[model samples]
Target chain A: MHLYRYEENPLITPNDVPPHHDGFEVIGAFNAGVAKFQGEVLLLLRVAERPMSDDPNIVKAPVWNPETGKVDVYEFRKDDPRYDFSDPRVIKEAGAERFLYLTSLSYLRLARSQDGRRFTIDDRPFVYPSNELETFGIEDPRITYIDGTYYIYFSAVSPKGVGEAMVSTTDFRTVTHHGMIFAPENKDVLIFPEKINGKYYALHRPVPRSNGRPEVWIAESENLLHWGNHRFLFGLREGKWDSARIGGGAVPIKTEHGWLELYHGASDDHRYCMGAVLLDLNDPAKVIARSERPLVEPEADYEVNGFFGRVVFSCGALVDGDVVKMYYGAADTSMACVELKLDEILDSLVKV
Target chain B: MHLYRYEENPLITPNDVPPHHDGFEVIGAFNAGVAKFQGEVLLLLRVAERPMSDDPNIVKAPVWNPETGKVDVYEFRKDDPRYDFSDPRVIKEAGAERFLYLTSLSYLRLARSQDGRRFTIDDRPFVYPSNELETFGIEDPRITYIDGTYYIYFSAVSPKGVGEAMVSTTDFRTVTHHGMIFAPENKDVLIFPEKINGKYYALHRPVPRSNGRPEVWIAESENLLHWGNHRFLFGLREGKWDSARIGGGAVPIKTEHGWLELYHGASDDHRYCMGAVLLDLNDPAKVIARSERPLVEPEADYEVNGFFGRVVFSCGALVDGDVVKMYYGAADTSMACVELKLDEILDSLVKV
Candidate 1:
């Protein structure tokens, strides 16, 4: 279970990132992917920014133009019946076909830490919206080092839906995008550190139109582009903290027992928490033991304040002997860290 | 504008179609496609049927099995909050991805008419859902006869989404399915009677998730299987009866003025009505003139009382001299007929 929080709990905040060139404010910098590349600990942080407007009725979002390769602002008025703004983070258009658009823009930023606690942030963004497919923005990156290649998997947002795209980088500066690895209505795609039984495996969440159940699924790939033999990994537990939905977090850590996976789960009331799931090493699709209780929920003021409240979302973590260092987003507004003893987490996992 | 209604307002009702072999009840038979073959007029009717359940809390929809060649029922509990039953015809599953399922089973039936007013209904269904793609049953068939072949276009529904499919037949009894002419999130397809500029053109409706608009689109085909060269035909008008959504009706009727299209439109309040649009003869995508008002709304008791109230939607219309005989569905429950003088409708169209 996640126990001790760092002395300086709020590791990263909105003020850490520079303001937008278009007079926008940095809303948050959280949900960072922890990685150790080239003898230095790296954090790929998801930085959310919102445009500044004089009128209270107007809301703006960054719209990507495929033709000119530029991001333009799309404005929607509050009084318009065509749009429904029930949620602060999302705006739903009213008509025959439903479309949900986020109010803010999210892009990845880089940060480096020597002690894995104190970090130095980069001024420039690591990734931003480029094509019409990424009209909304890229978000929530999870890095996996496989065959000397760091496969940075992130959610690609567009009008169609949230899909998973991967960019591979040997050196941190330059990366090659492999395009959309997962189709629309899918998110939280995480690749394993190594191949399982001579095949690449990934954990993804598909929001099925039927049943309305967004469950975590495992899929095997021969070329990584073409994925098949999908297997249902696990589903939400009724009358539990994770009764709504679940997604994979961080690359799976290999152990004698199984592949230890730290995952994020949300309750019906939208309270997010972390949990551990142990998968069979050979057959990663097989669910072994799952946490009966949340590893950590929003208990601190920083975890329950600003933007969306009552949230603790982990993007990635680093394994060091029996200790697991987790870098997570708090309240969807800022970044924080917590340490979990690897053996203690493995012991806490119980069969449901 | 829908000047006269047939004395027998509801030409075909639940009593007309045979009940399911499994003690189910026939709900309604409406939205018939019109065609004149072998000196006799025929109407392809979409007959909706459902199982008579003892429990009021349980809702059931008939699902067709391609392998078994039989219809099986799918049930949902009313107590589950996952269902959005606000719309009487469609029950939407709520969550990340939205899916709308019909409450009744619809199958096409053959009805022959001598006077075009009184129709003799057949006991057996002419066309039923025969594939996994059509598990939700076929609906809203529009017929276009070209080169001695009748192309029947209808909306096919399943767990995936609603799509457009077609069947070609020389003899009405024998039909050859072309298999999903248009992919999911699309329907209401009406093919043209002849090739336009050496290419086959079809009118379709695609629900774009980006804009939340379900607008009518025109697409051309070279081999009928491969479709391309798509053009936006028209969309919903604000503060109007057709403000919610619109779809193509009968095949384009060529006139000296232009090619006249009779289409169905629904308002946000779920009021369905018929409308007219005039398109350029050579370039069918170019909208020349449109009716400022709906041709007909729910007026008569037959069109006012049924499964879905306040609906008068047409699938096909036949032209004989200056009289346009329109066959339409009433209240989404029963079939009816109305006649309009060609000169009157043409004069009614405004350039706005």
Candidate 2:
């Protein structure tokens, strides 16, 4: 895989601007979405911000107060038996509700570029959650273009569950929310380029029956709102490097061979990397071929250790002529960009 | 799934004959292995014998030529490509060298009880392959146990890949040949009384890959030969039911669930089935909660239709405790058998 980075690496960082409220440290600024709009490159970034406190014994985290429709912060002792402060992502207690430091709500920020490099970021957040369900944060935004509509699908996390929601915008500024497209406890939703035959098709990660681990599923519908004919696409390759979890990444592109999709997978150790797959054009449920190698990984410092470690996540990409521009979050703390030749990536796939 | 039986239900059925060539048809009914000690219930079947004819038109219908080690059949009126004279159970021409035909041989037969229930069969083959690739025409045959070392699996085809082969014997006694396992190039070999996690395990069918159709892949591997991975575990489900092709039938016995299997599915049309998988203890692969599904299918079928069809097939089930019995034919002609157990089948699964 060819990776072309910006002359100035870490295109987006924590110091670029404070993510949320004051007195909070902003980190984990990584790529959330990347697109070419009106000749200018646009990037949606996920910035992890946490409260700045000096008390060594105090651990404050954010929690959605459904009753109040506001985020609440609670402080727990470092040695509290009920709380597991060992995990950097969340601070949870055995029987008590889980929470992030109230100062940690994430919002999407915008960054614009002219030559697909050297970006200028906006001071304010481009999007934010308005209700308690999304009070914790809004992360991983993926952009898709259909006809003349630009659809932005993102992960909305809250106490209820991790769900998928969509927003459409023609000019970035004025956007219309499409509510939640998927039910709670689901994420990694990627819609196909065009309707198959005449029905809309989408690839989603569903945790069925709650007993088995997450697996890929295909859903179809006449309209995007009502989906049916759910079928299992493929499951995680057991005993392989991606034995843990898998999710959708860049929007699927229509190709002569099939529907080319870039997806992310994690091992038991939580090392995130990107892979590809080709699906039958007429029946998106059929997998034509899949990649045996990852397109990207957490090799840089910003991608190795940060607010979290060993995470290289992408929410979007732009197809320019024969090249693809991908923007990804590295180590959960910084944003980076890479260029790949479409033909080269496809050539790397392993046909069994 | 609609099932069509020949004019004879349990067609080419099982019969009780003292182990001997005069008593049955085709033979040498067993998978390749050396665990041949202990009492084994083998099938003795009849090997179909067609007298030579002098007429060129009648002689042109596929005939197993032992001297040349290939089927000698004439393509009358080569100009009209849509000719359909060969057996539907096998033989078809897609294009050029891609001709699909039943690789007929001999077959393996089973023993039936006077009560139409329990039965005692021979332990040796009444017949064996006349050639190399299949020095053993022995095909799929299912087996169940009444006591110790009692096992059976059959499917006997001819070495010339034209007729069926059946073989059977007890304590290596007067062997009997029942006939062929099926016709030729046909297989979805299955044995029932399914087991798993300390139960029985059966084998079944699934089609092979062709013109974009799917192929059969087995799961169970207790001692390494017996299987339980459910056939048709992967394939394309288009606009029509069984649109892709499928095979293998009934189900195997394993613990609580019984193992169910079938042939592969060719797209719109094409392909063949074979192989097996394991099922749950009480539920069987039929319940589907524990088993994967369809472990095999026809990738090669001689007579999938006509007097036969896309080849490769199996039927009948005999169990010896947790051990399952399976019988099947290749290209619709030859037969063979393999023994498997519930514990062994469950251990071979690549669980999701």
Candidate 3:
């Protein structure tokens, strides 16, 4: 397997993007959904921000209150036995249900690049948490340019549940909310650019409470709204890189071999790596081949350390001739890119 | 305010209904969804059956295996620290996600009555746990007869999540599944018998994990398969008889004033009672009035004792002129009926 790492490795850092609100600060700028528009590559960057806090004993959780139309900070004392803030990303209340609050709220911000290298970040957020379903804020946007509309699907978190929502834009000016397509405890959904076998297909990772682990499942839809015929596609490899959980990464790229899908997998210790899965062209639910080893792992200095460490999560990618331009979130902090040869990736896959 | 208890109470008991499979016993036969078809009263009973395990240290959980099309038993040792069987109904695993498996699996069995008092329980299940979503079992069904078709909405539970699913039958011979109408962490859905203002209305209770308690919500649909425009209807009352959690019970009865809905409410200590809520005729989402006190509480010995004590949950009722024939599940073990005056219920509700 061959990977060409960019010299300007960490393309867009948290310092590159400014916060949407006054009291908030940019914590992470990564896991962007990408597309090509108007001769420039567009990145729907997941910009995470948090309230300015100095006290070590106090934990501040920022949430977009739909009633107030602004961000509200919920402060919890570290000494409180009712709340657990051991996980830096989420605050869990001590209960059977385990009420969760995010440490930082995320929004999708637009970033433009002419050569798919140097980027200019937007001042305002492209898509902010607007409804009660997204009160905890949105994260990990995956953009699929279908027909004339750019469909951006992201994880909408709230007390209701963690479900996937869709927002579409035709000219990058007006946006329309399509509500929640998939129900909660589910995320990392990627819609294919085109329909397969007369029905729209999507790859989703449903976090099961029991029986099975979090695995990639395929669903079919007629109007891209009401989905059914859910089938289990594939799961994590036991005692391997993806032994813990796995999810769909970038949208599947169509090639002569099959539908090539680059997916992210995590080990037991929460170390994320990217791998590939190839599916049958006609019946996308049928697995054809899969990656024996991860194509991209947390190896770079940027990937090894940041807001969160040892993670390389991809949301979108583009194929140019025989080269695949893949953009991923490193350490859950900043955006980065790596180029992979299509032929080499096809050869590396182990046939199912 | 007024209730006429049937003299021959506990209409259907576990002993009345025989087990479908060998080496199994009917533990509970309750929560019957009522309907009148061809001058006969029909009760879709939630019959819970479990394996006859004689060993006190061992617990056997029965699951409908779709692959083998047979009931499979999963045995767990009482001394196993990995599993918690203190609830007696559910076996929870020691994990953050809290994997759950039901102690006894339930399915809908048809019970026919000529006089709405004496009934004949079916030998086989009318609607069993067929799919993976209903692996844990289908419970608490609410039936609504609209345009010559009987629509039965019930809770489908599994490791995936607890969601509301729909099943329809015209003659009770052939059944059709409409898949999951609502996503996980949701149940207790009751569809109105008739459309309101050219749209179908449903009352559902979504179990929120973080912000709100389990509250009743209203949703509208055109095709009944895809639902949207979800709005919160009402929630639990503090320091009241119905304080813990509330959910829609039977199909709403349409009257001149409004649509009268009988609902079940539980206390913090798990004492279930029946209450009423009146909604506007044209706009069913608007609350007109609600019961200040429970119309039916756990008063009888059957309701106060059994498998699950102090529970009086209703699923269906029939309106005959000014008198309403209500069917309820007593203590999650047996079914019972009560006669309620329509005008008395409307008068008892406190205006909003």
Better of 2 and 3 by DockQ: 3
Residue-by-residue lDDT tens digits, candidate 1, A259-284? 98889999999999999899998999
The Cα local distance difference test for each model comes to 0.80, 0.54, 0.87
Which ranges in model 2 have alpha carbons more than 4 Å from their true place?
A64-70, A95-103, B1-352
Predicted structure 2, TM vs. truth: 0.49
Each candidate's clash count: 0, 228, 0
lDDT of 2: 0.54
1 or 2, which is superior by lDDT?
A: 1
DockQ for each model: 0.06, 0.01, 0.27
Model 1 reaches what TM-score against the true structure?
A: 0.60
Q: What local lDDT does model 2 show for residue A168?
A: 81
RMSD (Cα, Å) for all candidates, in order, is 8.7, 20.3, 3.0
Higher DockQ: candidate 1 or 3?
Answer: 3
By TM-score, highest first, what's the ranking?
Answer: 3, 1, 2
lDDT tens string, model 1, B236-262?
Answer: 899988898898888889899888999
